[model samples]
Target: MFGVTILGNNSAIPTLDRYPTAQIVTCNDQLLLIDCGEGTQLQIAKYRIKRGKLRYIFISHLHGDHYFGLIGLLNTLNLMGRVDPLSIYAPPELEQIIQIQMECSGTALRYEINFVPLMPGYTGVILEDKDLSVSCFPTQHRISCFGFSVELRKKKRKLIPDQAKAYEVPAAYYGKLQEGADYLRKDGLLVKNDWVTIPPEKGKRYVYCADTIYDVNLLPYLQDADVIYHETTYLHELEGRAAERFHSTSVQAASLAAAAHAKRLLIGHFSSMYTELDPFLEQTRPIFPNTDIAEEGVTFLV
Candidate 1:
């Protein structure tokens, strides 16, 4: 149930076939919007994503391609009579920006909006809920951009059904057993939680590199990530151009994934200049074999 669904994968421009940068990170029942590029709400509808599950919105930077659709999405949620509180994490300026829009339009939202400002060069855990934790780190982009790392925590322990049954533990109480609670028998004997269950396996991690130039310092945030979404705005031939724009090339993205030892790499944020996407994979696979294009509407399991 933990995965990322791409809403928009293109950079800057919204092409007829592709869109700007946006993604939905699904952590169990909760959904987090990673970016709200133009056409994001339509893409969410087009993909039939459960908008009601969206609890948080994260903006990497003020770049139009990264957050232009945020206001529209928020307004739509209000029009739909959504009363659930929504939390937004982004740069400090975004709060004022959203406030200005709401004031100018004389719009009052039906739901509560919590704005958490991310200061420049900030690197730390931003959110921790019952099911997931999210951390943000700085990225080398044209503006003050950030990359996010999401870890879906394993809360329940692994239960040994045979052992539990042998201990005369009722099946109805297995849920509590998996939660590390000791079982009390009818005869007053206590069965240790560890006797029937083991600690849960380590959690899986998904890292989103957002928009960045080739920088090795990012390895700390990406190390041992189960999946990483890194922007490949250009092919290897356009590496110079990518650097000039503070965007990354295919080869550079692959190199970062390889350096981080990520299990898989998802590359997107492609420049509109390239009509076809095969070259990106072709160039990346040699450097990191476990690389795939972050195609819109595709859900990548973390």
Candidate 2:
């Protein structure tokens, strides 16, 4: 299963009901944390997310709202006897920030933390496994920031059972055939893997646009994404204010998703001033019919 669970959706100033930016991308049993805001660990527990499966953490920027809870989470994981090494993808400055906090507190982690720096203006694949791939690209924000693109893909080709049976390929060798291996029988028959299988469909993509102002340059990454998550920190009436803060309005986010032809649009990073979220949907739905509020604890399957 490939899905994103919203942990915290509010912007910098967290409200009573909403929190700062944080999300969990679940790919099968593995979990990737997109951002760690204040009280993220508590939210994780509230949502019943499996902390043991969390393998990677991606911080969009150095903003306190995005990563202030990181050290606390690390401490809790260590106390809970977590031994697996974790990887963090973030700006280079975060490495020092984490180190300084750990140093001052005399806290030495039992597990190793592999830090992969996402330098300014850098964009490329950061992590790839058999079932998932992740990449990061720059986003226009108040500071140096990045947006992540997560793709869930199958490594094996699609298997055609009828063709395999007609070729006299044993059922036991179906797995190997799907792995693109040809087979030779004792009767001197060569069965090409392509004869029984075809290439798998393109991977499903979920692009998180992080914190950014209205920028058309992001269309390449958002193009035809299964789901695109963009920040709508303000309503359409406050477009000028959003631009001043380097944030996007509800309409702007929907417009980009419509232009990119994204299948679904998830808008969050809402301002704390507004209590009700319906207005945001009301503003975006007309521009892009398929839009959803990034409600806390709700999982959006890709």
Number of backbone-clashing residue pairs for each candidate, in the order shown = 0, 0
lDDT of 1 by residue, 5-76 (tens): 999999998899999999999999999999999989999999999999999999999999999999999999
Model 1 TM-score (2 dp):
0.94
TM-score of 2: 0.97
Worst-scoring 10-residue span by lDDT in model 2? 177-186
Hey, what RMSD does candidate 1 come out at?
1.8
Would you estimate the TM-scores of all the predictions? 0.94, 0.97
Per-residue alpha-carbon lDDT of model 2 for 8-60, expressed as tens digits? 99999999999899999999889999999999999999999999999999999
All candidates: CA RMSD (Å): 1.8, 1.1
Error of 2 at 301 (Å): 0.8
